[model samples]
Structure formats: structure tokens, C-alpha cells
Target: MAPRILLCGDVMGCLNQLFKRVSSVNKSAGPFDALFCVGQFFPESSDQLDEFMDYIEGRAQVPLPTYFIGDYGFGAPKVLLTASKEPANCGFKMDGLKVCENLYWLKGSGKFSLLGLSIAYLSGRQSSDVQQYGVYSQDDVDALRAVAEEPGIVDLFLTNEWPSGVTNRANASDVPAGLSDSMGSDSTVAELVGEIRPRYHISGTKGIYYAREPYSNIEAVHVTRFIGLASVGNKDKQKFIHAISPTPASTMSSTEIATKTTNTTLSPYTFVEKGSSPKDTTKRSSDSVSDSQYWRYDVSQKRQRHGAGDGDKLCFKFLSSGSCPRGQKCNFRHDFDAREQYIRGVCFDFLNKGKCERGPDCSFKHSLQHEGENYADRRPRSENSSSKRSKECWFCLSSPNVELHLITSIGENYYCALAKGPVVEDHVLLIPVEHLPNTLSPSAEHEVELSKFQNSLRMYYKSQGKQVIFFEWVSKRSSHANLQVVPIPSSKAALVEKIFSLAAEKLGFKFVAKKFDSDSDGRKFLRAQFDGNSSLFYVELPGSTILLHQIEDNEKFPSQFGREVVSGLLNIADKADWRNCKYSKVEETKMVEDFKSRFQEFDPNC
Candidate 1:
């Protein structure tokens, strides 16, 4: 069985460094069985975060399981990476108290579970707040009490925050003297831990504060500190391990239940070569140092020791393969097959980006080639054919004067069209199928489908080396969901100029150059003139002091300001009415004039 090694700390970018150190250590200590990653820095988005998990898992590919315990979003379901099943997006609640077998996400807090306590409910607040200070209200206390009473439960109470104290409240008579005295004034988490001692406690917060010696009731206390390992081995031998040296070398501080030997020597792997032995005072003809100065591991002692004798022993053991007559193998031969294989597997699995020779038989399908093949070849023909179809009007099913093509097809009439413009490729317009007023809420099913479609389209376009600018406009006048797409320009200057020109011509907005004084209080707003009418839009461009605003008549314009704003920004706009245009024009015109006047007032010497 692999050694069950738990790495608990405030994990930052130390994962890569940790793997390297672990690899070096395994040369002697051997490979650990399981790795428990306990702390914050867990990625919220599965796509964004999987790289780190994959890295660790890949390195320790020798069936050494790993598990992560941390805070996740409420109602966010656990993602099962092993089977590629649809991830759970609901609250974090465990079906069973113990998460047994394989890589698992032991939900930290929230949700209804018999054994697991929702830290949010217990704290009478969100999980985030509870994690920061470990504070809990009265209502939260009640919820915790109810969960504690549940029978036949082996609960390893996990929270992103640590409790004020760690003690057993269930065994009232056996309660520690310090905890019993402080019970009344103790916080909710403290009281709960004092009453019912869970098997394990993992917190995301930092700091290490262990009670005095003979701390047996509590199993293991993991805290994030600059100090090294503090207390180890759960409740049994509660020894506080402090660094003999001043500063902490690792992020986590451990307090062991018992004191262990402190070896200050760096591992043999970390060594600097010297030309010759101090006694000899003679350098070899070759620049490289002789094997005498190199560090070597002592197999019998199971530790790294320096000098010639050590290297000779290691060389014989390794070179002779334990089969030489009279046991005359190389001195440094240490048969560490298991450790070498485990380390090799981990490096090959996670660190290396080589393709899998076993193909489907390989556990980690991490090859970029596989991803490309899956995305390109595995898509359904129907979806592919649909993508190739021309853009037609959602209402008339005929091509518009704009020579529009439908990019997003949400069934027959429900489609989003794009107008191909010379300046911007595939300038798009989104329109709904049925001619209903522009009030539409995408159904959950629609959202899922649309999101997936959008992602695939973006990926496909990106793979093909094309850039796209997506825009949407929904107007109440025509019960059509209008969406627009513009092709992105290759040159930065060209793209900006193109967008500015397009917005000025089509949307009656203009981009102007203006300067502001160093002490100017307000940003300069631009005046957008269109159709003998004008409005103000804020623009804040690089190397310019003016704020660019996309302004339009709120009431008098044919298009709603909201819709126009979305279109101008190349973002989705909410649908709104354009009925009371006449009433809105007076106020809108004044607003634009006022903004333009302010810009002129702030003009340099003015």
C-alpha cells in the first residue's frame, strides 16, 4: 500500500515545487500512498482549475489516490473527473459521512446532510463569512446541534475555517479542563467541537495555535503558517513540533504529538560539487569534481551522508545489481524499484506532455492531439451541417438586404443572424423566430444549449485562426431577437479605428480626441451627432483623458439606449421599448449638450 501522506497548507504556487521536493525525497522515503490537498486556492471554474489537479495526479500515477477538501459554491455540485459525468451544480452535501474510494470532493459546507454540518447554516451566514472569522450565531448553533445528534455517522467535519477550539463535547465528563472552563464564552464552532469531536478538521484559514501538551482528544490539527509541521498524528501523541531553526521553510506549521529527530542537512539531491577533498588539497586534471566530494545516501541508515565511502557503497549496490560474486557490486547500488517506478510514473503522467503510446488504454487522456481530434471529428454531422447553413431572417426566412447569414440557429425561426461587412467580418444581428414583443427569457435548457453552442463556435473559430466580435440587440418594435457579429481586425489600430467609424456611421456615435488638465475632477464626455440630433457618450481611450460614452435618446429614438449600448459595446443587450421617443428627446438632447459643454469647459486652458 502507498503511504497515506497528507499535505495540508495554504497552497499557493507551491504545488510544482512540492512535486519536485517529493520526487527528491522519494529517492529515500519512498512514494506516498495518497495525497490529501487541504486548503484554499482550489479553482472555482472546472476548466480553469483542472490543470493543477491533473498535474499532481499525473505525477503520482502509481495508483496513489488524491482528494481535495475545500470550500465550493453553494448549490455547486461536485465534479466527477474520473467518469466524465455531468458535474453536480447544487449545494455541497454528501450522501454518506465518509467519502470512500478514488478522487472525491468532500463538500466543505452548506446543503442538508445527516452527518456533515453546513457551516453556513451553523454560522447563520454564508460559508465565506464563516471561513474568515469562525464566528456563528444562535440559529447556526441549533443546526449544528441537530446534525451532531444523528447516529451511525462517522463524520469528518470539514470547514473552510477553523474553530476557536478543538474538544469533545459528547463526553461531557471527559471534557478537558481548559475547554470545560471556557465552554460558556466559547464561540459556536468551539462549543460544537468541544461537545462533538469530529474525526478530522480541515480549515482553509491561516495560523497555528495548539493547546498545551497531552492534547489527545482531537485527532489532527492542520493550520497554515510559515512554521514547519506543528502537531502530528491526530489525538494520540500530541507533541508540538517546532523548528529548531528560526524561520519556517514551508508554508504549513505542524505540531506533532511526539518529538521527532531534526536533521538539518539538505537532501543528497541538493549538493554543490567541490574540486577536491580538503585533505588532498589537489585538483584533478579534469574540471569536474571527483566522486569523493559528491553526496551519497546511506542505505542502512536510510539517510543521506556525504563522502567517498558512502558513494562507493551506493555505486557497488547499483552497478552490481545485487548479483555480483562475493557481493562485489558497485558501492552505490540501492534497489529502490518501487520508489523509482512511482516517481517515474508521476513525472510521466503529469509533468510530461508526450502522447500516450497506449492510446485508449492510458488513464490520463491529456494529449492535446486527443482534444483536437475529439472536438473536430466527434461532433455530430447534424450540428456541423446546421453551422454551415446560411443566415436567414427569423421572421421571413428570406435573406435580408444586408446579405445576412444565421450564425446561431435555435430551431427554425429562432435564430441570430450576422451581416458580413467589409470593415468587420460577419457583423451579426440576433432575432427571435415568432414575432412577439422583445420580452424573452432564455429557458434553462436554452441557456445550456446556447452556452455550449457559443463555446464550440468560439473554439472552432479560434482553431481556424479567425477572430469574431459578437453583439446582440433585442427591440420591442419588432418581436425579433436581433444579434450582430463583427469580425475582429488583425491590427490593433485598424480594429479601434474601424469600430469607431462603424459606431459613428450606424449608431450615430463618434470618437474624438481630447485632453484634460492634471487637476481635472471629471472625465471628458464626447458628443455623438447623428441625423441632425446629438447625444453624449463617454470614451476613455489609451493615452487620452476623455471618457467615451455611447449616448442615445432614451425615449425618442427608434432603438432603445440599452439595446444601442449593447450593440456599440459588442455585448448582449436587454430588450426594451422605443414607444415614448417624442417625450424623451427633449431631456436627452439637453443631457448631450450639457455633457459636451462640460468637456469644452475642462479643455486645457479653459
Candidate 2:
């Protein structure tokens, strides 16, 4: 059954009147599962402190199961601080604190399942000074964004302040009197609501009632209804409480849920440029990274170049940022594959300008491998040498050059080794025990063990507040396969896809992106894409986004492509080449020991 819920505006310590109204409604409307309060649940004046303490001190009872945000005001600091210190309220508890029996304080920002309904909320107003308890931080805003990316619809979103531009596209008469154009709303909340697309968005801070017309959300099947209520017992007697009994989205069929009303209007949020469509603007804006070290691309025109094009000549504009103004209509070809084939065995800048400026820093092949002492000659023997035998392969456990101290863990068919020139701390390599050329052809037993190690690393890194990315380059050469595992800051997780896409554009190639449920599924998909015979590169990003590319037999693809992209994401492009990031034997051994000690609990082999 769908849950019956009651939503209230700011109480401001008017508990007697609020519950009197709630009790009258409960008796008539009878049983509501829960009452959710927005805006200031606590009072702003000391005069109402006695009445507020009645409920907090258990002298008076909360009429129903109540959950509330807006946890700031007169008496809130003392009350909430006391609740936070309780051991029962520790570590991300969704049900929140059992504040004086039936009342619950939904502190901070989070999403939780309430009687099958997905309820997400942000407590407190936006402020530059996050040290104050009355305001939300960037971390809280970002956490909700991560929640927005999760599957399923948000039944309700509660915020303390109004989303800026909430009045747009609404009937003028519907807006309450004396409301300003801005309505003192927060743009961050606006951006969040646009992303979350909750079925109902409720807020209360201005002490005025405004029930907006249902508006359509970008890329969503259902529409969102926004309602801003006035404070409880306001002088104007504006509506302060709303009743809703929405069926859980999980129970509704897609077609039924997609059904829209005739009153639906365009979203009030104008997030992009004037001429661009909402979907196009969303894609580009969502992929953008603010880091100064990383470059942004013109993703708007990227799709136009994906269609059929003529000639093998490279499009210079497309080569720089993955988009061409002329697109397919351009005389020159805009294909990354064609550019890759053309640039093989030659430096791209050198080919275009008749001279290369990067000198030793350039990663591209200035000359073929057969040419004496090229860039390939300076790489590690394990990665670049032609030794095909396990006895001679530098990565092999039996090989004399294999660093025994770097071996951290060993499974039935795979072993973990610290990267010789680590791109980031805790960066490790997963290698097959057998003399295997690539991971795709590994047996089922080997594949399972590989997944265990991947999961183990993921858990260990997550505990350190970091996210891990895995990438591998498989070629027709005799060298063994080693999947590079690099740890990145959790905050930069959103930038991984954008940085890699930008890097791919600069290098004149596009990676085929797909979602997979597991590492096994990812490998199977890659094998199918290449028909099990081609050299290919793939990156398993922070989440479900897997980027794949096939290497042509004659193509001189950079073996360090994965590392280069990750280094760029980390804003340490100097360490893209392993040779430049070498450590002394003592330092390397210390790193190994530190990693092993920290990783012991998560190791499946242990």
C-alpha cells in the first residue's frame, strides 16, 4: 500500500497549535504514516522555549512519528548536540535520532527509505561559513548529487530554503502576495532539485504559501510538483500543511508512472545557455570539471561528427577538443580511428607542423620501433621488451628481475605487485600467474580470483576515503598483462570520465563507453567487441562507466595511455611516464610494507 504522509511548514516552537491542527486532521483523515517538517522546527524567540521543551523533555508527546530538517534556531544547538552524542545516533543512521520518543531529527543531508518511499533531504540553509550549525556545506550538496545518480525515483525532497527561480513558468495569481522575484532562494538547491527530480519538493523559509504547477524534469519520465508552505500559525493564515498519499514508484509500471497531466509546464530552472536544448546543456555541464589543470571540451558538437564523413585528412578543430564546428559537413574527416591510423609511427604535432616542440616530454612515437633507440627503447623491460618466455619476462614471478619485495598478495592464478613507478600512493598491479598475454583469455577460475582481488582493493581504498580506477592495455606483443589499479580522491570521482574523454580527444581517438555489472561482465563485453582477436584498451572508471578502445594491429598506440589519462585527472601530468616517477629501492620497499599492512583485512587470500 502507498504510504500516507503529512508535510508541515516551519513550526517555530508553535508546538501546541501545530499538533492541535495535526490531531484534528488525524482524527478526520485518521492515520498518516509519518509527518515530515521543513524549515525551522525550532523557535527563533526565547518566549516559545518553554513550549518547545515540553515535547523535547517528554512532558508532552509528539502526536505522530515526526521527522524534521531545519535543525537550527533558538534551543536547537543544545538539543541536537545532546542527541548527536548518543551512541545510537552514530555513523550514518538513516532513521535518525529517537529524539524524545516519536520525534526524529533528520540532521545533515541524506536519503532514506520510509515505508517504501525514497525520501531525500538537505538540512539547513546554504552559507559560506559551514562552521555554523545552521548551514549546509559543499560536501552535503555533493553527497545528495551522488544520491541523485542512484537508480529509482525520489518520492520526496525536503529542503530548508526555496530553490531559486521556483516562481518561473507558474501562474502569477498562484504565487503568494509580497513574494520577491528571487524569493530568497538558493541556486545550489535549484541545481540539486533539477538533478534529483523528486516527485514532490517541499520547502518553507519565506513564511508564504506557493503551490507551483507540476513541471517536467529533464530526461525523466515523471513530472515534479513543488510546494512551498508558510510558517505554522502565520498571520495571513496561508496553507502550512499538505497531505499526500503517493504510490511508491517501485509499485507503479513505467507506462503508468510516465503518464503526465495537462497542466505540466517546462522546468523553472534555466541551467544552460539560451539557444541550447536542455538535454544537450545537461550533458556538457554535468561532464565539466572545474580543476584548472584539466581542459574542457565543446561536447555540444561532438555528436554531429560521429556520423559518416569523407577523406582520411584529420580535422584539426576536432583533434583539439573532440568537436568540429563544420562536423560531418567539414571537408576533412572527423574520425578518431582515421586520425589514429594516420598518426601511427609519427608524432602528430611533427606531422602537422614539420617540427615537434615537446622534445623529450612528448609521449607520441616520433619514429617507428624498428628505428634505433626510439621512445620505446627507454621503457621498462617488462612493458616494452620482446622477451616472450615467462623465464625471461620481467613481470613473471620466476623472472630474475621480478621484485620479490613488491609482491603484496597471491591468489590461485593471480598476484598483486606494487607498480614500479607508482602514479599515486597505493597504486598496484594485478597480474596473471601464468604467462598469459591478456586477461580476456583467462580461465573461469582465474577470472573469479581476479574479481576477488578487485573487490578487495575497492573496499580497502574506500575505507581510506578514496576511489579506485582499473585500466589495462592488451597488445599482440609478447609482454604479459598487468591491470593498473590507481587510487584517486573521492571528491574527484566525478572528474574521471570528463578528464579521460578530454584526453582521448587530444590523442585523436574515442573510447567506447558502456555499463557493466561486474568485472567479469566487463571482460566478456570487451572480448565480444574485439571478437577475441584484437589488441584493445579498457578502463573501469569509478562507477559503472567503462571506457573501451580497440588498437589496430599496425597502429602505434601509446602503451602508457591509461596512466597518462589518470595522471592528467590527478593534475600530475609529469608522472604520466613511469620512468620519470621512479623511486629508490628503500622507498619502494617501505611503500610495499605500508600497503600490505593496511590491506591485510581486505585481502581475500589472507
Candidate 3:
């Protein structure tokens, strides 16, 4: 059974009125698990400050596990700062402090789960200027957008500002006329609601109670219900409290999803079930099939150890359009990230810190890369391959712009970076410290060192029950070449082989398997084939099988074909473009730190 929750509008430091109202509600509706208050938790006038402090300081008692977000008023900063200092209040999600027992503050912006329900919040009064007390910061929006990216559900979204156009868009005549006009809906908050697509959206500061009908969202499975409340001590005696028990729609069953997604056209950016694949894959007679097609895998014959991966999957229609007919019966990933790794905008991390955290995982281009300086020259590198190459090569390990913190480990010849937009946590790039065009023709010593590095990685991932796949696209214009290393569940390794072959086949090129006596021999063979003009597609399979495809100068080959294969195999095909997986620098820093900790023991250079 779902827990009962009581939600209220601004309290305005009227503890006496609040107590009386709660007592009345308790008698009438009685028991509720939690009470959430929004907008102006502090007093408007000096007379009410002492009474509010009394309740916050614990001189008086808080009735329940009361959480609130009215971040401004007479004594807000003073109380919040004090609570921030308390050790118990510092939460993992960066959620705010506890003022007194059972009383808490939801500061800044973040989300957390309560009673099996997900809740996201943005705290601050609406303002145009960058005021400390009011107005949302870019960081807040960035963090919220990041939250919106995670896979799954956000049951409730709480904000201090009403979403702009809520009244007009909702046309909720039930709300008092022009009440939301003076305040209007906050554009940022409104946009957030549209992106988050939560089951329930609650806001306050308009000083009126409004419960709009569930509205449609094209990219989400469940409809959203918007509620606005008036001040607690309003002279009009408008409702200050509202109560409801909503079963978190995130827990819906598959039967519900099947029902809701009838005729649902999923978003182009999301997963397209293989059965519904838009790409036509007509098999030719095996006798006439190219050597590449020989690797074709039968996905039907494979058994997925886990049923379709994460069970918290969202409804297809909900993810595609933010609204589903299933209500709470559907299942799929409602979290924006779950929809696809490739998002249709700039990197969220770059927007926040001018740097992207995901490296290769991020599908979006780093806006900083477009700065006047040649991005290739700006990467970190060692001494004088040319002051020019190091300066122009963005991938050079010695470049000033290099996010050194992203380096996972140091090797004798080559080093690794967590891809700026990594497809997975351990996805890394193996690059030579000295600038070079491609891995096709490394000297024997470098080959041995690179081999050792690969061996070490192979052994480590094997212990973890995973397989690491290596691929590279050496551009003629590339300042340096780095081997793209990705890890996939061993179960998927067979699938990876078949997909790459299919991808190459679709592009009218065949990946010809070439066996070499050793790594050095393979490098020499590839170097002769590079011809200083033709582009190369290369892959290293799990059992030391190597496939190479050459796209001569005259051919039009999809440069993204390699990444497409990898992303498709991982079910994140949207992120093949790199522009799709943009994430925050803070998160990237975390990714680096995590990699460092995991790879430290195996690191040969460091």
C-alpha cells in the first residue's frame, strides 16, 4: 500500500495557525506518513520571526518528518546556514540540512527517493537578476537536467515557483483567475516540468490552491498532475494544505506498458526493439554472402541472463512523448537518460562547467572544442613533436587544456583517459605519450609495451567476468591516434561481432579478417595499407581475432560506423555521435577518480 502524504503551501512562520490546521487535518484525515511544505517557510514580518525560530530551534516540536523549500523570507539564511553546519544534514545527493528533529530543508536542486517514490526539487524564489536569495542558478538547472538524464522515474517534482503557462497551458479554471499571472509561471520551472515529466508536480507562492488534471507528456508514460497552493495565513482562507496518496508510477508492470503503448510511436532517439527495427535486414543466400556476413549472430538463439536488463523499464509511449495511456501500469525507463544516451542538445556538463564529464560517454561535442584555438593542438602532449602538434592536438596528453584529472593510469608507452563522453564507466582510450598518427605502425618496443597493457587490462576485466573490445578509427587529419577500448558483458561479445559485420556490410564495405603472426607484424601490415590517404576501420576481438576494413580515397564511408556498432551493441545507439552523452565536469571528475582507484594497481607508469 502507498503511504499517505500531506502537502501544504507557504507556512509564513504562522506556527499557531499551522498547528491548528494540522490538528484539524489530523482529526479529519488523521494519519499521514509525511508532510511537505513549499514556498516561504520563514516569516514575512518581524513579529513572526521569534515564533518560527522557536519551532526550528526545537524549543517547539515539529509534528512529523516535515520537509520544506521556502528558501527566502525574514530568517531563512540564518536558519539554513546553521543546519548546513550539522554533520547529520549533509546528504549524499547534496540535499540540505535538518533544522530540528523531523524538520528538514531541501536546498538548491536535487532528487531523492522516499517511500519507494522518487522526488526531485528545485529551491529558490523566482527572480530575473542573479540575486542570492531568489532566482535559480545555471548550476541548479544543470544539476536538475542531469537528474532528468538518469534512467527510470521521478514520482514527484517540487518547486518554489509555478511553471510558466501552467494556468494557460493547463487552462485550469479551477484556480482563482489571475492568481498565477502576477507571479506567472516560471519559465525555467515550466521547462523543468516538461523535461522531468513527473507524476505529480507541486509548487507554491501564488497564494491559491489548484489541482490541475493530469496533463500529457509526449516523452513520458505517465500523465502529470500539477498542484499550486496559497499561503497558509492568507486573508482569503484559501486552502493551505492538500493531501493524497499516489502509488509511484515507476513501479508499473510490463502488462501495463503493453497496454499503454498500443500504437505508440516511440521517440526517434530511444531504443527501437529489434522486431520493430526501421533498418531493413534482408539476408542473402549464404553461398553469396560476404566474409563479413559469415559472423552474423542469431539473437533469438541467445538467452539473456537478466530479463531485458534493468526491470525498471518505462513505457514506450511515455518515453517517446512524456505521456502514456497506461497510467501506472506501464514499464520502461522514464528517466531521460534511459530514453537514450544520445540527447538532442548541447552537453549538460559543458553548460554547467564549460567542460564535459562523460568524455567518450557523452554523445555531444564539447562546446569548448569550438573555441578559436585549434582543439587538436590544445590537447596534452610530451615535449616537441612540434610545439605546433602539441598546441593543435586536443588529444595530446601534455596540452594545457588536458583535463589531467581524467587520466586513469600512466603506462610506459601509452596512457589512458576515461573517454570525455564515456559509453560506460570503464571505457577508456589507450594513447601513446608521444604524438603519432595511428596505432597501425608502432615500433616493436611500443608494440610490446602496448601488448602488455592490453594483456593487463584483459586479465583484470576477465576477473570481473567482462570482456574488453578494442577498435580504432585513424583519421588522416588526426594529430594522434588512440585505441578506443570498451568493455561489454561477456554475454554480449558474440553479439558485438555480428553487429559490426552488419554495420560494415550495410555501408557496402566488408571487414576482411587478417591474421598476423604477432602484434608487430599486424602493425606493419596495417601501415602498408594506410597509404597515407585511405581511412582505416580496425577492431580487436576477444579471441585475438582482428578485422580490418579499408575505405579508399574514392569511397564514401560512414566515419561513425565503428561507434555506431559499439553503441548499438550496448543499446545506446543514440550516443554513437558523442554529442549525445554530454555530462558534467563534476561527474567526469568522479568518473576519473573511480577509474584511478580501480586501475591503480595495474598502472605500470604511475
TM-score preference between candidates 1 and 2, better one: 2
Better structure of 2 and 3 per TM-score? 2
lDDT (Cα, 0-100) at 54 in candidate 2:
94
Off by over 4 Å in 1: 1-7, 21-32, 43-63, 72-102, 109-147, 151-157, 165-186, 199-204, 207-606
Which candidate wins on lDDT? 2
lDDT, candidate 3, 314-394, per-residue tens: 333333333332333333333332222113344434432346544643334555322543322233434642654464455
Tens-digit per-residue lDDT, 112-199, candidate 1:
3221222122211233343332233222343344344332122234443444322323211233334332322223344354324442
lDDT-better candidate, 1 vs 3:
3
Instruction: Candidate 1: give its CA RMSD in angstroms.
Output: 27.2
Candidate 2 accuracy as TM-score: 0.53
- Output the lDDT of residue 584, model 3: 88
lDDT values, one for every candidate: 0.32, 0.74, 0.65
How do the candidates rank by TM-score, highest first? 2, 3, 1
Give one clash count per candidate, in the order shown: 78, 0, 68
| Per-residue alpha-carbon lDDT of candidate 2 for residues 223-295, written as tens digits (9 for 90 to 100) | 8999898899999898999899998765565457678988887787644543343233233232232211011
Stretches of candidate 2 exceeding 4 Å from the true structure: 170-173, 273-606
Task: Quote model 3's TM-score.
Answer: 0.50
